[model samples]
Structures are given as C-alpha cells and as structure tokens.
Target chain A: MPIPDHVLVVDDDPDIRTLVGRLLEKNGFRVSKVADGKGLQQLLEKSQPDLIVLDLMLPDEDGLVLCRNLRSRSNVPVIILSARGEDMDRIIGLEMGADDYLGKPFHPRELLARVKSVLRRARSLPGDVQEQDANATYRFAGWMLDVPTRQLYSPKSKKIFLSGGEFALLRVFLNHPNRVLSRDQLLDFSHGREIEPFDRTIDMQVSRLRRRLGDDPKKPSLIKTVRSSGYVLAVRVDRGGESHGSDDSGPGD
Target chain B: MGVEPDKIVVQIDEDLAEIAPGYLENRRNDLKHLPLALAEGDFYNLRILGHRMKGSGAGYGFDGISEIGRAIEEAAKQENRQGVEQGIADLAAYLDRLEVIYA
Candidate 1:
C-alpha cells in the first residue's frame, strides 16, 4: 500500500495546530502537529513530511527566516499561514520560498486545495528527493546550481556569494525556465519584505544576478527582461547526474 | 449541529480523542481561574485567553465556545471594563451550565 502524504503543520497556537491537523487528516493526508519551531525541528529530525504548512507569526523565530533557511537546504514545498493578510506579507512569505501562502481566518477548504495543488506539483517530478538530486543539478549559461548547498559556482570554479534573497529569486526563475514570470510571481521567491506594485526591488535583484552571472544588463542573455511585464531565464537548464539521499531534514509553526 | 445549548454536544473527532480531553481540561482550568484575572483587571491576559478560545473552539467542533471566546476577546480589546465583566460572566455561566460529551 502507498503511504499517505504527511503534512507537518507548525503554529504557536495549539488550537490552530490541532484545527489544521483535523482538516488535513480529513482531506486524506497523514498529519503531524507541532506547537512551535522547536517542535518542528524535532519532528523533522525523525522524518521528512511530503509538505509543510507554516505559520508566519511564530513565537520563537521569524517564519520568513525559517522559510529562507529551509530553502537554502531543501526544495521542500512550504505553504505559509499568516494572520497578516497584507500584500506585503504574502509577497515576503512567497519570497522566502513558500510554494503557497494563506492568511488567517482562512477557509479550511482553501487550505486543502493548496495542499493538494502543491503536493501534485511536487510529486509531478520524482516523488523522492534523493532521486531528484541524482539528476537535478541545473546547469545554464556556464553556471552550475548546486541545489543542496544553494551555492552558485562561477565559470572560474569560484563560489559566488549570493544573498538569501538573490538566491531565492534565482531559484524561482530556474524552476520555471523560459517562462515569463511577472513581478508578483517574482515576489514568490525573493527575500524582500516591503510591498509595492511591481517595484524596482525585483529589477535590482535581476541586475545583481546578471552581474554575478557575467551577463551584462545592457545586453543580458541569461535573464532577459520583457518590457512592461516580467523577466525570464532564457537559457536551457541541463540536469543529469548520479544521485544520493539527503542526510538532513528540517522547520516548525 | 443542534442549537440545544443545554445539550451542547462537541463532537470532537475520534482522531483527536486523546488531546480533546486535554483541551477541554485546559479550558476548564482557564475558565476556573479567569475570575482572578478579571478581579485584578488584567485585561491583556484575559484577552489572550479569549483569543485562544475563539480560535480553537470552532476548529474542534465547539462553535458555542468560540462565540463566547470571541465576545470575551473583543471586550478585553476594547478595554471596556463593563463589557469585559459581562463577557466573563457570560462565559462562566455557559461553562457552568453546559455539559461535555465525547463522540
């Protein structure tokens, strides 16, 4: 028999945790519950869940930082839950690599839909992370992206330093190669917390990424900017390699 | 699902059996000590309790509990001393009268 997908929900409020737990269980997923970030880590040490439903206003640590940290290591799909439903909050949550975002006073049915949607997308690729890593190294435009370490290797074999925000944006673009990602879509994977409609923040990150990749902003070939819309990673990404299982799994509510 | 407040039945899911009892116990204890907070005029602490109740009650098949909790939280937030007292009284009266059944 196939194992039911496990969803670990991390929240400071026991009520919310339990409530979400009930909802997820009713939706045909195995559910584990935790009250704080600490509990989340402890659970991750035991096993990796299929997806994570994270709450932003944690008592111990900032959820966005936790999301970024999680992204730096794994491609685990995360759905952020926050009471702050402002556009800024949603953007920041997405920027932290949350695959999806929802606000409090949220409809339980909506959360279930997002849970299923993310799981479907994540599973569309090989359902196993180990299998993915075996051939998931994306190489494009003379740059090799090590998904596990989140390290960018230059043509000179030197490690390029990338801010958490920049790396997140780049990852989002890479995952959706050749696709025109709008500013709102860009916000889903960058680390900016401020909110504005199609602000220059994404542009700045793109410019920074171009410089790091040796792609000139004036004649950018790697990440091309489309007028009045968004940007696209124009190069084909190559993924072929032997794979290994990840020894670490991690986060909390 | 019935509005028979006297026969208020919280049909906690069987999966939550272990924790539901604890949740009820905790709320009972919280409600027990709430008078102390009210007498001390610690609206902040009172508000926190109400907030938890409001969020948890409906999630666990206890809409009535959540409604009372929301009222308490709102009163505390508004800092209306009279409203806070009335809310606390209402919560206490409900808890005192309602019966708990495990489904």
Candidate 2:
C-alpha cells in the first residue's frame, strides 16, 4: 500500500482539532493535532508533515508568525483555518506564506477539497519552488532575488523577506519584466492554477509583493496596475548577477 | 395551561455521529458557565466561549447555536448585559428543544 500523506492540524479548540483530525483520517491521511505553536515546533523537529492546517488564533504564537517561521525553514504547504473571514484577513494569511485560507464554520467537505487541491498542485510543481532555477539569480531595478536561497535584497543591501506567495509572484514579474501580464496569466504562472471567477488573489499578491519590494501601492513604480486589465513590471530585468545580494541578516530579519 | 416547547430537529452528518454527543454535551455544560460569567461580569471568558460557539456550531449542524453565539459575542463586546442574558436564554431554549438526527 502506498504511504498515506501526513497532515498536521494546529488549533487551540479541542472540538476543531478532533473534527479535522478525524475527517482527514477518514480520508486516508495520517493526521496529528497540536494546540499551540510550541507543540508545532516540537512535532516539526521529528517529522515534516506533507501539509499543515493551521489556525490563526493560537495560544502561544499567532498562525501568521508560525507560517513565516515555517517558510524560512521549509516549503511545506499550509492551509490557514481561522475565524477571521474578512478579505483582508485572507490576504494577510496568504501574505504570511499560507497556500490557502479557509475560515471557521466551513464545511468539512470544503476543507477536504482544498486539501486535495493544494496537495495535487504541490505534487505537480517542479520539485520545489526553491529548487527550480537552483543557481539562477534575478535582478530588477537594483533589487536582487536568489532563487536557490529564496532571498531578496534591496538596493542598499537591506534584506527583505518574501513570503512564499510573494516570492513566486515576484519571480513571475522578474521573468517577464516590462510587460502587461493579465491576472489569469499571472495566476497560472505563479500558482500553476486556473483563475477562479472573481478571484482577487493575484491583485492581493501583487500588493503584498510591491510592499516587500518597497514599491508604494498608491503609485507603484514597479508592478504597476493597469485599470480594468492587469499589471506591468515596468523595470528592466537582468538574470546574470554574480553577486547573490549582500545582507548579513538572516531570514525573517 | 402549560405550553410545550417547540422541537428543533437538526440533521447532522453521519460521519460526525461518534463525536457530536461529546461536543453537544460540552455546550450543555456551558449553560452553567454562561450565568456565572454574566453574574461576575466576566465578559472576556464569555466572549471567548461565544466566539468558539459561533465558529464551531454550524459546522456541527447547530445553526441556532451559532446565531445565539454570534449574538452573545456581539453583546459581550458591547458589554450589554441584557443582550447577553437574552442570548443565553435563547441558547438554553434551543438546546432544550434540539433533536439531533445523524444522516
């Protein structure tokens, strides 16, 4: 028998933890439950689960901080489950490196479908985002991005951390700099998925990426938004940078 | 003349049958906590419990509980004692009338 995928569910609510764990187990996945960030870190030490279902309102640490910490160390897929159902909350969760976000009171089947979709997408991706273009470095508008290390450095050598979503979006922008890419194209390129109807995922991603790049959203010089259409990376990009950016600070610095 | 309370039948997922009893029992226990929290003006604990109920109730086939939970949470935020009291009463009535059917 093929080994079932393992999933870690981190939620402070015992009822939620039990429900989600049981549901995943019934769906042929090995499931583990943790109530806080401390438990998450302890479990991560021994084994890396295939995916994680994290709650935003954790006791010891917020889910966003945990997701950022996970991104710095690994590319494990995360689906945030939170009670905060606002659009901004979902965008912020995505900005913190979550692959997907589902609010509390969600149907079990909906969460199941998302888990399957994310797992399938993760499998179809070329190894890992960090491994793809392992040795390539991208430069645009005096900013540097090292693909292998997933590091971004500003013109003045100040390091800025990009969440997984931000990094992928930025990479797409750098690859096709100075061109107007539609939302569908950007979503397909960055996420390898078809655009859902009325999806503002790409727009929110662009906003987050711009913030990471220090491009003001009010009047972004890079990643300029085209009204009623898409966005354009208005900078010239060069790929052959010998220097892999300079910053003494580590990830999440 | 004594009037009978209305029976509220909720059909829940059969997959949840094993755990739903314990979950419902916990909510029943909250009946005790709700009055104590209200009497002591422990709005924080009341808000936490209300938020949890709001987030979890509908998923478990208790939309009425979720509605009451939302009301309680909102009232606690505003520190409206009357609203919280009404919400607790509604929750008690609903739980008393609830009949869970696993489908």
Candidate 3:
C-alpha cells in the first residue's frame, strides 16, 4: 500500500483534537495530534507532515504567531480552526499564510474536504516553483516584499521585517490598490474568511499593518479609511520586473 | 425570604463591564422562560443553562458567577428546592451587583 499523507492536528481541546484526528485518520491520512505550539514544533522536528490542521486557540501560544513562524521557515500548507466565527479571524488566518479556515461546530466532513483541497493544491504546484516565485520580489512605495524568504524591505531606511499578518494584509492591499475594500471583503480576498459582528479584530490587524507601512491612522497616507465603509490602498503598487516607466513612479512625488 | 448579605458577590471583568449591560438585557429577554422552568421543576433544563453559564461566566473571568452556577447545578441535581431557590436568588443578586458596578 502507498504511504498515506501525514497530517498534524494542533488543538488544546482533547475532544476536538481526538475527533478531528480520528476523522482524518479514518479517511486514510496518517495523523499526529498536538495540544499546543510547543508540541507542534516538536512534531514538526520529528517528521515533515504533508499539511497541518491548526487551531487558533492554544493553551500556551496564539495560533497566529505559530502560523507566522511556520510560514517564515516552510511552505507547508496550513488550515486554521477557530472557535471565533468572526470574518476577521478567517482573513487574519489566511493573511498569515494559512491555506484555509474552518469555524468551530464545523462538520467533520467539511474539514476533510478542506484538507484534501489544500493538499491537492500543494501537490499541483511543482516543487521549487514557490521558491522560484519568491525569488521574483515586488516593490511598491519603497517597500520590497520578498515572497520566498517571506520578508519585507523598506528601501528608504533599509529596514527589513514584516510580521506574517502585515505581509499578507500588504499583499492584498497592493494587489487591489485604490479599491474600497470592506472589512468582510478584505478578510475574504486576503484570507478566504468572513468577519464576525461586533468584532474589532480586523481593525486591530489593519492598524498593525498600517504601522508597518508607516501610514499613520490619525493623519493617513497610503491606506486610507472610507468613513463607515472600509479601507482603500491610496498608492500605486509596482511588482518587480514590471516596467519602471511613468506608472511605476514612487509615492509623494 | 430576606437577602443574604454574603451571597456570592460576583464581580464583572473590566473588559466585559462596558458591554455587560447590553448583553445582560438581551439575555434577560431570552431568559424570560427561565423562571417558568424553575417553577415547573425542570431541573434538567436548568442544569443545562447552568452549565453554559458556568463555562462562559468563568471564561469571562467571573469566578463568583461560575460558583453560583455550580451551586445551582448541584442543588438541582439533589432535588433541593430551597437550595435551588437560594442559588437563583444569589445569581440575581450577583446580576444586580454587576449593574451597580457598571453604573
């Protein structure tokens, strides 16, 4: 028999972990379950799983941070499971490089489908293709986004570093420059998730991203808020290798 | 029949305090049938509600409310009518204190 694809399930709740692990294992995937980020790290060291099923809530560390760390080092596919039904959670998860997001009280069958879909995508992408794409960096507003290394560069001051959320949110904004994106739309396009009512998590993330972009929320530039609507990228974005002609000029003249 | 001075003084967390009033108001509307359940001796349903209250109340950092929920669950399980009534009264008093805290 062929070796089954390995999957890592990270969740603090034993019931959920067991239920999910068993369901995946029964579906022919070799499964390993961990309770927290530390355990996940340990598991990763022991073996490279084909994909990861990660829970946003862990007893020791937030799953977002873990996802960010994982993305920085590897391109392993990740699916986030969050009890928070808010759309912001989904967006943030996707923004942080998660391949998919599933809310709690989810059907076991749905989770399996998502896992299969991500795996299929991963398999379809030829090995080293992501690395080659990453080498082709994009520059906008004096900021350079290194895709493979998963790092950002500030050309003016020569600074480099962007948290996972910052990188993902920036990617979405740059890709859709000058578009008025509602929080829900931002979360959906950026992370493949929805925003929950009465949740300000997305606003918090956007503020964080703005700080990285050197855009002040009080005296805004670059990413501007559309009062009672959403946000829009106010500057032009030029990907690397694109013509550096008139359209590719830097912002603020 | 009289209020117990020491009936679990539940304190609301600062984060939850701002929205507690609105949340409690909505809960009160949904909980209109709660008293009817208690009066009809539907301890099972009461226990279920108590369990939910225990989890969320504790999660939001209200230990006293969770304790009262636990007490209510225990009392209902034992079929202690007076204890159940006392638990309900304590819960109400805690809610009142929360209102005062927010006020």
Q: Who wins the DockQ comparison?
A: 2
lDDT of 2 by residue, A64-171 (tens): 999999988887899999887789989999998999999878788999999999986764563354345567888877888887788999999888987777887777
Which is superior by DockQ, 2 or 3? 2
Candidate 1 C-alpha lDDT tens digits along B49-97 = 7877776675555677777777787888887778877777776666666
Residue A23 CA error for candidate 3 (Å)?
0.6
lDDT of 3 by residue, B8-58 (tens): 444544544544455455335425655777889998867755544443344
After superposition on all CA atoms, what RMSD does each candidate show versus the true structure? 13.8, 15.3, 18.6
- Candidate 1 Cα errors over 4 Å, as ranges: A22-28, A82-92, A103-110, A125-253, B1-22, B96-103
| Arranged by TM-score, best first | 2, 1, 3
Best-performing candidate as measured by lDDT: 2
For candidate 2, the per-residue lDDT at A178 reads 54
Tens digits of lDDT, candidate 1, A192-224: 423233554777878888888888788777777
Q: Is the docking of candidate 2 incorrect, acceptable, medium or high quality?
A: acceptable
At residue B27, give the lDDT of candidate 1.
77
CAPRI band for model 3: incorrect
lDDT of 3 by residue, A123-228 (tens): 4443344334445566667777777677777767566667666666666666555555668656655453223334536688788888887787787777777777
lDDT of each: 0.72, 0.81, 0.68
Superposed model 2: Cα runs more than 4 Å off: A127-253, B1-5
Residue B37 alpha-carbon offset, candidate 3, angstroms: 23
